[model samples]
Target: MSAHVLIPTTSNLPAPRPAPDRSGTPTPGRPNRERGSSPHEGERLRPLSRGQVEDRRQELGDLYAEVSGGGPWAWNEARADFLRHLASDARRPGFSLLIAETTVLTGCAYGFPLIGAGPWRADFGGHVREGLLRRVAPGRLFVVSAIVVPPRVRRENQDRAWNLARRLQRRLLADDGAALGVTLVEARNDGIAETLRSWGWRSAGDGTLTAVPPGSCRVLVLTAGT
Candidate 1:
């Protein structure tokens, strides 16, 4: 069976209060650096053990709510669904999570290694090249189930959000020593699809896949070096 996945949705919520500057003690009369001027300032990506994920469930839920505003889905319902999927994903083999934070959780991403032939070829509706499938050995294909950075972050500084997501994905793939990373974004989520493409994630075939439904989702791929 294919793993449960949460396709990210756009949120219009206002940006949360800026995370406190933890780089150093603030000096009186010194001007604070502009927020997001340096995307990497005070930010670090840390892998979360399964136990740590459980411990931070509440925080994760809140972040989901904050980023997945109540638009097409109610905030409560969306958050509940996110928690459920997260629980199931955590059980998958090779599941991994990384959170980007300064003083608070800024963003997060997580995924697991695909098993056997995986669900891509079967669900891809014959769009994936057979040779490509064969080349990616079993357990070498990582599926990035979700990358949740607040929409506000993207709006405030697109580069910052992009960098965070890119770092999260790269770390996960490197940690697993996977040959390739893949993600399925709804075709309608142009914002995400474009962002992923800009970050060097290429479309699998014809830029769309049938995993969710024919032409409903797009399969994006990122090779180890790329």
Candidate 2:
């Protein structure tokens, strides 16, 4: 087991909050992509519209069915509950969720591309080390969690996960102007530490976590100044 320790601290500032319109729809025009271009391209990260989220969720359902044959992924029930909570969070101020999809692959059923202005409740206190402070400031875009589902779990699938995580990190970090801290959470061990490293994510020196009862569950946190 690894010991938990607090990251360093730099400064304290008021956190920024997201805005909203009561209609439960994104204001007026289409949702903004940070780059002013299509999503697959290097577009800016913006809050996904309600319709877009539903569509992405449906796609995830399809992917789950195809891959698991209707069985659940490691902890499918809990993951499903998390997705519902994300939808509710989107309705509140200072919270936004974005979903990025591609025909080539699918991500976690509950996991979207990233969350914006996410309430990053750091259990380990901090000035984050690992050379990220210079990249992002406080109250930009904070990614509370992220999930990546490989094409398959075999040895060959390692490359797929690595490529997917790298693309996600790039897209999320492209618009640092409206971003803060990006924290990516994934199943630990299982040959993923190297994949995250390949994507330029350091350990953050925040230690690691394990699921209760010693199941095939572990969690690692990675941060990048966004």
Candidate 3:
């Protein structure tokens, strides 16, 4: 495991909070909400090194369970699957993890650069033109594997949650200097698919490209500066 690295918070976002207390609790402070300030002003966003991610696996799993919203068995299964993916993804070249928090972990997003032509490309089923792929440079394409934000946050202030999600995605892409970002959303998950579309992601293809059951998911893409 490499030493953890913390990316400096962007100037447009809120400044970092005072150091946490010995108990690891964030100090109480008012959010800076000047005009043009980020809606996520009260939260801090930081990138986690692979080492840091391994250290926080349990905490991340719990957060995933909470966000997934299921009974005990389902939660357990979801957490396990999340852990498995995290382990595999962490080893990929240029893997990056960004987490948001205030008093506790509120959300997380992670991904790795898409390097070379892999089996996953076949999943696109030719929807992603070869010429387009060459133009973007596969190495410059980042795949956002997951974005997990608790439901309560969305329930209380959906706009804030939306901004947070966007911040996480953009930061990840910026960190890698990626030209394009890609993610897949289940076709049945209309809420998330709609959210991604509203955020300027265009659908490139459907699950027929990748799913055992056609139409199970949709592929969405966001080019840099879009």
Candidate 4:
């Protein structure tokens, strides 16, 4: 339902005309037009469902660890171990794992988002920066993870990873409406930054604007909003 109201700003006011519908019929039982309304009334966003909001809270928490001040080299070993754990549990219901050379298969799709944007947090772990975003909201609705092969591995996997990222963003948009965005972080030379620019991400600010070492991983940041 929709209604319009009018208010008088001056000391003296005149009468107002009634509002009409598309058919030109005056709406009956219309709201009082003299009352003043809050200036921010229309700016409030529609409240998301409780479950969806909780999931967003968790994702925000996970994002903190997605960006690490430390270098990726220091964290590769632990990341590998975590991937191994996820792979071991592939047979479980609501769970699967994949190992690929240059691309993330189905099981690794969820984690691809985090790998592109993560500082994943677990109770025992301080901050899990590298890797994919495996577990989703609502307790096992979706989960995924991956192993980033050595540089010797062909870059073909990157294409697969890109595809997975696109799918993930689409899913997130469907669920949360306009409440998400994606960011891409890459080595200054990986051309990842250029790719992000082409995709319509206005460069916000440089990350850790230091002399990035050769082969250092890049960071991509994506977000969605309602």
Candidate 5:
């Protein structure tokens, strides 16, 4: 993990929180070329809206559970609540959820803009910059709440999971003009943080956490603009 953790210190500065705590990663069959399949082979993509989130809420929850390593109850609760809010126009109007399904539910990338102060501030541990608060207000920042890929996908083709993730991020960049992107990753888990680094996510080196099983989370940032 990075040295600049998000925990509040004497400096009274808080770095980014663990990505909603807990975790995820992905694999699959193939979506077909007409679907403009993945760079590898048969893998198509589908972009969803808040409305779909409302409709597939249960399925979404199940997917997260199937892939994520268990965490503290509080961390789990916060994660659930965050997804609930994103399903509404809660963060409006820049949230995103993309699912990649082939023979099965391969993976997903989901998020919402971190704008305008609200109860959400408490989720990140109240020590962020006024500038960040201002920048995230509505359009300046986007927070990735979840990223998941089923074990089947991971077992069959590891690269495919990342391919789906990259596609999802690309779509987000195409749709949201936000300057920055943020997401949480397990700091000491099995190489998840390292994989993200290869994908261009920069760690803050701070041990900020949003989930329990204490000291296992850290946030990563990506300047998503082309």
Candidate 6:
């Protein structure tokens, strides 16, 4: 969930994928983060409040479907329910959302604290197994839920793109002095993991999560690491 969406574009080249260390733990390193997606010309991003996201749920779902490369009606089939729940959670006290603006919703992401009793705590086996349960506390662990950046506005200006991401991350996290930031990505999407690592994140562990599709996920834990 580093809420980091490592968009794969034709311009991106293949790189080595990270593997678990000898101890079978997620290996941490400055893995090369491949670049592909960026904001197209005349496009900009703005931090959106939970209310804004709820108002634009349909748009977000459509963008998500397109970015996901899903078939027609994928929005209704796959994204509708997910967005509903995400928005609902955003309405809660501690949840947050981020949306990119380009005359419409170009990209978006949302997350919440992992501390206390919440959806994230539905299954804490992954945290317990990794000895991370003790670290979960309000203002401590932030769980990035989902990040979507449609292919429409990708690969525009490298610097601008970086700025957009930085802004979004900044908004998602207030300088609340959280000790660790956590995100879960599908096993197949290791590019996100690598990019998080490049951003001072490391492989914390791997586990099954009840996310959009309920599948295998690798936890990318952000800390003062390579």
Query: Highest lDDT among the candidates is held by which one?
Result: 1
Give all TM-scores, in the order shown: 0.72, 0.45, 0.70, 0.26, 0.55, 0.59
Better structure of 4 and 6 per TM-score: 6
Q: Residues 65-181, candidate 2, lDDT per residue (tens digit)? A: 343332344235433544555555445444434344454444431222222333433321232343544454544434434333332221122233234344454444444334433
User: What residue runs in model 1 are displaced by over 4 Å at the alpha carbon?
Assistant: 1-8, 11-39, 71-73, 117-127, 152-162, 205-215
Q: Write the per-residue lDDT of candidate 6 for residues 21-62, one digit (tens) a residue.
A: 311122366432224433243445555666677687777777
Worst 10 residues of 3 by lDDT: 1-10
lDDT (Cα, tens digit) per residue for candidate 3, span 3-94:
11111112111232233232212346844342244454677889998889999999998887666654677668767877877887788788
Per-residue lDDT over 90-183 for candidate 1, one digit per residue giving the tens place of the 0 to 100 score: 9877889888898899788899887754454367435456766677887798888877775544443334434566677788899989999887
Error of 5 at 12 (Å): 29
lDDT of 5 at 157: 33
Where does model 3 exceed 4 Å of error?
Answer: 1-39, 121-127, 152-162, 205-216
Count of backbone collisions within predicted model 3: 0
lDDT against the true structure, each candidate: 0.68, 0.37, 0.64, 0.28, 0.51, 0.53
**Full candidate order by lDDT, most accurate first:** 1, 3, 6, 5, 2, 4
Model 6, position 4, has a per-residue lDDT of: 31
| Native-to-model Cα distance after best TM-score fit, residue 141 in candidate 5, in Å | 1.1
Residue 199 miss distance in model 3 (angstroms): 3.1
Q: Which parts of model 2 are misplaced by more than 4 Å? A: 1-47, 61-82, 88-105, 108-136, 152-162, 176-181, 184-195, 205-226
In terms of lDDT, model 4 sits at 0.28
Off by over 4 Å in 5: 1-41, 65-93, 122-138, 151-162, 185-191, 205-217
lDDT score, residue 119, model 6? 55
Worst 10 residues of 4 by lDDT: 1-10
Q: After superposition, how far is residue 50 of candidate 4 from its true place, in Å?
A: 23
C-alpha lDDT of candidate 2 relative to the true structure = 0.37
